[model samples]
Target chain A: MKTLSYFLILAFSGGEHAGGGSPLDVNPGLILWTVVTFIFLLLILKKLAWKPILKSLNDRENLIKESLEKAEVARKEAEKLIAENKLNMQKSEEEAQKIIEQSRELAEKLKMQILEDSKKTANKMLEDAKAEIERKNAEAFNKLKEQVADIAITAAEKILKENLDKAKQINIVDKYLNEINKN
Target chain B: MYTGQELIGADTLKQVAETAKKTDTSWIMHDVLDANEIDLTPFGIIHLPHLNLFGFDISITKHVVFMWIAMLILIFVLKKVAKSYKSSLIPKGVTNLTETLILFVRDEIAKPTIGKGYENFLPYLLTVFFFILTCNFLGLIPYGSTATGNISVTATLATLSFLVIQIGGIWKNGFFGYFKGLLPHGIPAWLIPIMFVVELLGLFTKPFALAIRLFANMTAGHIVILALIGLIFILHTYVVVPISIAFALFIFLLEILVALIQAYIFTMLSSLFIGMAVHQEH
Candidate 1:
């Protein structure tokens, strides 16, 4: 066997072409060993290496799915918040508008009330001034009528004194008055 | 399109030599070995360029080394991740990342399709996604082999998905009920046999489609990037630095997207199949 191995080694080691060796010609034993080792390793990997590894991967996938679901819920909540904010804003705007209208109505009512009171007060003052002026004019007219009557009586007395004596003059005046009445 | 060394150019030889020297092979057959000078037209591995092995010819090459390395990485990464889950709720760091993906597959992919009480199928779905993604991403690495790029690998994965769908379906419904679920409710009696044949054929066809879809998608991206890289080589023939830089950046971005997309598509299709199997009506 040693001689055969030496011969085999000698044949292979000869100085020959550089690029001409077939794979089948070298290391048949090594090839067999390699195949067997590969199969064995495959079995061991399946048992010891792959099982635990798969579990971890499954865990990670589950984690990702859970996180995605949480993100979706958060997004929905944010949308609801935005919607609520818009609703509140609209409600406040409507309330503010209503308050402004009510204030304007109150202001208009106050202005109308002030105008009505001033007109009533002016009417009362005008009536009082007219009554005072009318009373003053009536008093002046009475005084002028009294002065005219005094002047007419004085003229009549002067005419009678020149015509007759005092007692006879009275009788003559009465007869003249009676004659004037008959005529 | 070319699987091995037939597509190798002169510069690819130099790269292979540099890589081989870096691997620290203390045993040397010859004192002076300029790999660039060696003629490689005779070997079938030439279809895959820029690939070489330590001390072999016309067989497995650096791409195979990358494949092996990817397998080792898958084992080591899975082991470390599994070990981290000893005490706590779940593992942290790389374990945590893997664990999240597993859960995504269980909850998003398997649960929706497989219906209630689908947690039991998480193991199988997680296994399929990680295993396929690992293999698919392996090809995105520089000088890395995409095991899923091979039709065989995709076919195997698709077959497993098919098996699971059937098994799960059978488990959910009884043996007879499972088959009966295939036919729609309104089919006339005369068309039942024909529909059964078509449905049976479709059952196989679904996995076949899965295999082709994954294999084509994974392989197409790599080939496009390889071709783009090849453009620089063809253009300058010698100035590979700038071209490599540009192509690497473009391919890196594209590969990252491709890696995620491939993982998603595999998981989606698998889930769809499982869903169809379990709940045939909806």
Candidate 2:
């Protein structure tokens, strides 16, 4: 029976371990209490701990996902704005260049026209001054000649008191001189 | 230093153990049988109250006290984490730790094992994991008791798991349908009775294994550590002291790993069982 008990102990742990108490000792009381305790613990934990924690975790996940999407949209918008700005700047620069080119051409044409007009007016003024001087010289020469003729006639009259034949001879001589001069 | 009769102290210990066994104190029996005594060593043992109801010994024992402590610690820490989450979703410190573990249970244990309708059983899985983990860790303390080391406690957990699997299956598949799903699609009628018995046995054994596995694993580690320390005294040799302490520490670290692994296993198995029931092909 002792040998059988030892075999039993090996097979089924019928004997106690270490000291007198075996950890495998069955207790109906403990089992009953444990069942009750575990159920209550589950209930209480499910309410206080599990519900709020899980909800918060889910909320955090959703919030993160949404934030990432919004960031992506904002980045795209910024890129578009930058592209538009570059395009506008390029267009305006071209227009400014065109305006500058047109104005330079206009300025060159106006300068050439002004120079030509001034040169023509200066030549005309010189011609008019020369003509006036020549006319004045001619008038003076003609007056002087008339005066000489009158002086000769007066002197001859004074020498011969009522000599019409002498005056007529002098006039015939002036005429002969005038004819020679004309020839 | 082989004093040939160094084992004489063992006989003395045996005498003391026998004397302890013979003591008329009502609580000693409860202590040995049900883990009714919480050994505080320096502070002295705490004997919980024993109660009888309808000829049933429904007493609150040491395991109960430890279990309550584990539960309270779980609630307190997780409650703080939950509250912290309200202000910001950014997890820091304890929240980070809890979040990592919580997600592990969900993604690793519940999701893969339970498959499509995994969300419903997350609460139970998470509870069991955290509760068992805390209980297992408690045993590592200087004089702390492992509630999970107790057979009754582990058995109770297994029973709850069994109930959940059954109830969830019944809810998904009607009573007869659930039972019918257990058998393969087309089988000989003679094989029905044999298959039924085997399947029924499979149901009970799965939970039974859970209970035994957790209890044995938890109890065995502490026992090994204790025995290693006791070796120095038993041999009456100073030579074994460092070796014994070193080995004990090693076992202690291993126990910590075992604690986490056991909790994961318990939760994983529960989820697997739940999946088996709810997601039957038939």
Question: Considering every candidate listed, which one attains the maximal lDDT?
Answer: 2
Q: Across residues B1-282, which tens digit of lDDT does each residue of candidate 1 receive?
A: 243433353345455556555542322211111121222335533343342345423233333444456656665776676556555444578877766676677667887777776777777777777777776776665434566665545666677778888998899887999999999899899999999999999999988888788777776666566655655544655577677768767877887787777777887888788888887777
lDDT by residue for model 2 (B184-227), tens: 76889999999999998998999999999999999888878877
Clash pairs (backbone) in predicted model 2: none
Q: Residue-wise lDDT of candidate 1 within A1-183, one digit each (tens)?
A: 443454454345433433233212333333333344346655766666566556555666787899899999999999999999999999999999988898888889888888888887788778878887787777767765665555445435744555767777677666656654573
Weakest 10 consecutive residues of candidate 2 chain A by summed lDDT? A10-19
Q: Least lDDT summed over 10 consecutive residues: which range in candidate 1 chain B? A: B27-36
Runs of candidate 2 exceeding 4 Å displacement: A1-21, A108-183, B1-34, B186-192
- By summed lDDT, the worst window of 10 consecutive residues in model 1 chain A runs over A17-26
In order, the Cα lDDT scores of the candidates are 0.64, 0.80
Per-chain TM-score, chain A, candidate 2: 0.60
lDDT of 1 at B66: 46
Error in Å for residue B178 of model 2:
1.9
